[model samples]
Target: MGKGPMGGGGPHGMMGGGQKAKNFKGTMKKLLVYLKPYSISIFAVILFAIGSAAFSIVGPKILGEATTTIFEGLVGKVTGSGVGIDFTYVSKILIFLLGLYIVSAAFSFVQSFVMSGVSQKVSYRLRKQISEKINLMPLKYFDTKTHGEVLSRVTNDVDMMSQSLNQIMTQFITSVTTLIGVLIMMISISGVMTVATILMLPLSAVLISFVVKRSQKFFKTQQEFLGHVNGQVEEIYGGHNIVKAFNGEEDAIREFNKLNDQLYNSAWKSQFLSGMMMPIMTFIGNLGYVMVSILGGYLAIKGSITVGDIQSFIQYVRSFNQPIAQTAQIANLVQSTMAAAERVFEFLDEEEEDQFAENPVKINNPMAGVVGREFQEESNKKSHHHKEAEREVAVVNEDEIIEIEGSVQFENVHFGYSEDKIIINDFTANVKPGQKVAIVGPTGAGKTTMIKLLMRFYDVNSGAILIDGHNIQDFNRHDLRSIFGMVLQDTWLFNGSIKENIRYGRLNATDEEVIAAAKAANVHHFVKTLPDGYNMILNEEASNVSAGQKQLLTIARAILADPKILILDEATSSVDTRTEVLIQKAMDNLMKGRTSFVIAHRLSTIRDADLILVMKDGDIVEQGTHTDLLAAGGFYSNLYNSQFEDSHEEAV
Candidate 1:
């Protein structure tokens, strides 16, 4: 859970503790724009709140009328000049007051229901938009922020905004209405007492302002430390095993305690200061009551006001201070809400990846109809040697289908994660259709970077990556990606059944097709052994499966995709020697008619590659066949020889 605006002490603690927005007015304007659709609902809430406050405010004044009636009747009875009391009139007043309160309560309930709906609707829209926005955001944006930080904006910030908006809207209107209504009622009772009550405002304001100013820094500190604490806990929890293995538990605990102590210090100070507000305001309110009582008594003695007027005046004075306090609390809440809004809007406004091309060139697979039919005929001729179930044919509409031969060219490609540092500089490569090209390099040789550029995860600072002679950027990103399949060193499997995870490659694939793809990647036998067979659910981390098994599942997914181009970035790195050989055979079958780029640190695996590109410091220093590279006795020869030496030494 993310931290909200108000921490341990609740709303009162947040009176002056909430962080202020950098651009309060601008953020508020944007928020109002977002609320435009709910304007009518919000307006209804305001009207209902005012109506509720108005009825509730009128009760004290009307009840005072009954009080005056009883007092006058009692005095008359004592003098033996009139009836004792007007019980009938007092009863009527009480009945009317009861009806007014009932109506007020009904209005209050309706407004609350409406406002609750509006706030929830707003939250729903925000979450939906944020979820959508995440897809559109550039990969670069996520590179700079943690997953937790991003998630906090979605969960905590949005939640805070929704809750605060709900309270602020209704409470603001009600408080203002009550303050004004109470003041009017007080004036109608007696001008002198009203003036006396009004005098307490300045003193109350001074005390509040002083406390707020003094506690503002502590509140800010508290919020900052709270985030630090949450971040630390999340980080440590995620990597607790690593920390323990490294004997860093004491360090982690010491760091946590430091942050915890700072949070405690600031929290207590802010909470204590904010907590003082009620007592301070209460003292001022009590002083106002005393002043009003003295003035009301004098006025009553002079026959300038009745006992009922005095009673109403005192009630109005009490009501007056409440709205003032509520307004103060609301001000802080509004600020907090705006701050959360700013963070949400900031994410929504981030630069999105250019997903679509203005004039997209449709993919035209020339081999779909004529070549495909010929291939099927060829397979039928060889049916005696191969099982009928092992042979497969794709039936696609010739008019709608388009495919590329998977020819790729990197023409003077230059790129860097940042402009100041050029990693892949003026790199060039050409891969023929259906050719297996191996990329071998050291750790930071820009091997993965090249794949990223080819996939358009990031564009080159200069030069072009062409697919089937069309610049990659010219094709729609989605369309370009559709022709490619990737099985990376780090396998990613979502929390789903094994069958569903495999089907993720092609969502509409039938169970038979999924099983065929799994069998092709050599994962079918292992999956069948699981407790629920293909129905076995992988946990969130997929920890139930071995790393090699995870890799095989990903390979099965890629096979299911049946991409025109295949990228295997150390795809068999995690598997044992036997499994690696099996995977290599599966990969060989998968790569037969597709342009495949294999990134491998194990030089032995890529011995059969059509072309080996030896890269060093971002440039391909040598390009040749395995035997030819060995004959050249250059960088590739040295790297291959070193690997052999390491293996030989290990065996010895």
Candidate 2:
């Protein structure tokens, strides 16, 4: 928690360039790796497809053989050469062909089963990995990307990969296998016709290849346009209040329409390109079929092949060319899945700090006595593992410390969101810890940035921060933060009971403890007066609850945690004056015996503060107690006098 408001490199920075996306070949290789986990299932799918393809050629072969046998029998009877062939053998052959088709159908079903499992499992696993990465990512990542855009990646992109999996893989195996098997059968039946079919293929292949490359370009653009549209919506909805307050509705509408227009154009092109595959493939397949029929029939008439042989050769030719055409389109889907894989893998590649450390501070039952059996048991465990138990023990019972003396001391801190503009400006401050330090300044005056630095959200560019005698970097982030409770001006709460919102401060706290915390924050009576009492449900971000209660709930949360430091940024600015008075008492109770960093707007709040540091342009202009600063009649005095001298005293 680098003296910042929260554990983040204050959320003001843009995303730096991320990992370059993998190209087509790289994407295909990575896509293949997802199949590695389901190799057995994929292998089965392929095998079934191979069998189905191989069996397909058998039907046409048998039909051609039967046609020859039947014609031979007819010629024998008519020519009085009945002994030339046996009629019963042809009957048996036809029956055998019937059995073969049934088997082919069965194998086709098994192929579907195997491919479905492979695709679904792989997609599920990849989504899980991406979800885990999102959790492990630092807050800085979310600062650049909106929740909705990120949400789209997880859902739409992943679904694209999953949806095409079975179709692509199964089609690939069947198409390629059928093409090879039928080609071999055709060669045996009539080599002349086989040569002719092969000759006509290269033209169609080259045309499809050109179209595929074009399609990929459109697909890439289509994906980017989607992200842009998602970004626009996320921003517009998230900043709805800002748009309304500033009366920039026209500007917002125009921006949204621009993004939406681009999305529509890109989508149309992408769909058109993808839709071209089937038409292009079918045309080529038909042209090849016509070529085989004409050439094979001409060869038979020229006594180069038998009529039955020509018929069978034509069937094999259609079987062969048909799958090749289908495979071309399936190849496009395979490529798209590879593209999705590139996106998914890029997310997982981001480096995350290791979460599971060997030693972390554990706060036992809070109400447990320092020397009681429960405390001793927890103490023994802490001393055995964390190694900072001694200091924690001393601070547990006392409010003050020696080295820090309610003062946050920065030795020589230097930091930035990146190597870009430095926000802290070689920040060094002797903020007396536990002192009511009021930081007042204009927006972006490094006010909230100061809180982020002290919290150690990001490692300082250089230097050390000491709390007590300990450098902050050595402390566990969660444990260190447990000592300070922060209530931001913009409050956020989860969708749950009001009790759970307050209980978030101490997850294991009892109902009684929760009620006690609420009472301390003057919210107990109000909650009891409600229909559900403590069990009342709060909507997402606590929108179901009033603004004042939301703040009070957070205050209760802080009181429950009972931290040594409290951070209140415009804590009372959101509620009415009557609620403010009620909350002021609660705030005082929560701030007692703790170091408080207060970012207050009302001059009345700071007048009572132990130290009022007037900040402007990211630097302190004046510092002293309220009276002393007013006596000097400098910047602090002017800011103080302005409140009384100023009009529009509606509320904070």
Candidate 3:
């Protein structure tokens, strides 16, 4: 019979959904590639499974000999033919049969032991590859896919693969072995009985195939709905406070119920179809059993077969149906596993970021500009201070100084999130070392997008971002990013001690350094008042602290990083006026003598910026010092005046 689609197969049993794979054959082939390394262990497992099945297949036949011996002896005694029962011979046969069973059990145990190791190791390796793949994937992937979907693939899908692997291999070998051995034993005793039993196979196959075809679609639907449910739950829980504020809990529950209902409809149908396999197989087996009994009796009456042979053949008939049923069950499991494998392999094959260039630049010291000895030795003939006109174009540090001066320039840049829609077009700007540049714009005017490009989080569609007279892309991504520190609007603090959160900027920093950074950010006194001082643990959301205090902790982190360049994206926007003043003071200290890019929504904050670039519709509409822009009376003037027009008129 064709197999029913596979759903969740372990303790959840029929209640679980069946997730059918679209490309079963292709996915299985890819999965086998991973098993190549464990081939030797798998081969040994196969041998053990075969041996175990072989021994079990011989047991019924051997036990029949003892049955026959006891019967003959009893019959002779009843007929008074001077022959009595041979208890010793009967006991010997029974002992031999028991020995065979013990051996079979041992083989089965060995097979299970070996296969478990193989499955777990394969799972371990796949998890490692997936972990590494996460780092290689571009930010675009995370942006496009939900957190729940990615997490399901990594955890649920990988786990499915591991459990299914253990079951499929051992069951497959044992089923085949038992099927073939039972057929041979049955035929050796009575061909007519064997033929009768074999005739029912086609009928069972027809029933199973019909059910399988109908169930496949439901299984596929089940998985899709399951993912949707997970995504909705994750979204609702993550933003539960927002949901509560907006009175959206009912809507969230409604959405979850819809997805859950879809899952239930598909799950029960797939479960019912698969659950029918064994009962139907048992009916077919009973039919074969009755037919074998009648046919064997006729053979015995014709003197063509002995009583012992008929008994042995009957046992074979019963054993034959079991493996047939097991094979069908395993077939269902195969579909589920293939579906999971497809997802895992799809994730592994995702496009990775561009490869690192050979001899990429390295920033050995944050404060110094000295080139590595290797670079200097290779180009020893070049002087440390080569004239700008004489600089080599082939290498990033051709001028021999590997130091970053924090000077940044965007030359004729053009960028778009997609090809058809350009956002920032032909924008160019230059910031000299140790200058504070403020970018002010309306929402969606490409202020933050520029910072992303500057960090090489996403490369520009065209044109170059140069740092210290070298293109940012020319340096290793790790080395290039190390020179800059960012404090974004959304503060990220993991569940750890307060001190540990601050030390995230520099993992190896000492306690003294961490305390100094906290003092610099003006949060030291507040932390000292806490119950545990710096040792106080922050929960997952860091909700134990106020928003302003969380902002302070992030500022302290940036201070500890001590980067050559700093990017602040509205670092004070979320706090109260008093807290904003404190944050501004801390920021001023942090920005001292460091090239900084500040993205501000409040016009008042950028009044003293060295340069102010007012943005409109992805273009820089005006750029100058605040006073120069006010004197010019351009778009910047209108935007700045709009904020305080009422106050200005009242003062007049």
How much lDDT does each candidate structure score?
Answer: 0.85, 0.70, 0.81
Cα deviation at 365, candidate 1, in Å, is 8.0
lDDT of 2 by residue, 1-652 (tens): 0110111010100010011235878776767776787888888888989998777678988888888888777788889978766668888988998888988999999999878888888778878777756755766777777565566567755776776787788888888888778878888887767777888779778886776566555555555665666667767787899999999899989988997788677666656655675677678767777877788778766878776786787677667767876765565455556655676666677655333224333334243223233433443343211123342332233322122234567676666788786665555566666788888766677777677777655667777776765666655455456567888878878999989989988777899999999999999989999899889998776777788888888899999987777889867776888888878888888988788888878877877788776776655667778888889998777776777776546453
Q: Lowest lDDT 10-mer window, candidate 2? A: 8-17
lDDT of 2: 0.70
Task: Name the top TM-score candidate.
Answer: 1
lDDT of 3 by residue, 551-637 (tens): 989999999988899999876767799998889888988899899999987889989899998888888889999999999999999
User: In model 3, which runs have C-alpha deviations exceeding 4 angstroms?
Assistant: 1-29, 246-259, 366-401, 645-652
Question: Model 3 clash pairs?
Answer: 1-205, 7-18, 369-403
lDDT of 3: 0.81
Mark the 10 consecutive residues where model 1 has the least summed lDDT: 383-392
lDDT tens digits, residues 113-213, model 1?
99999989988888987886786577788888878678878888898888888889899999999999998888888887888888889999999999889
Candidate 1 clash pair list: 364-402, 364-403, 365-402, 365-403
Of the two candidates 1 and 2, the one with more favorable lDDT, higher being better, is 1
In angstroms, the error of model 1 at 548 is 1.7
**On a 0 to 100 scale, what is the lDDT of residue 369 in model 1?**
32
C-alpha TM-score for every candidate: 0.90, 0.78, 0.88
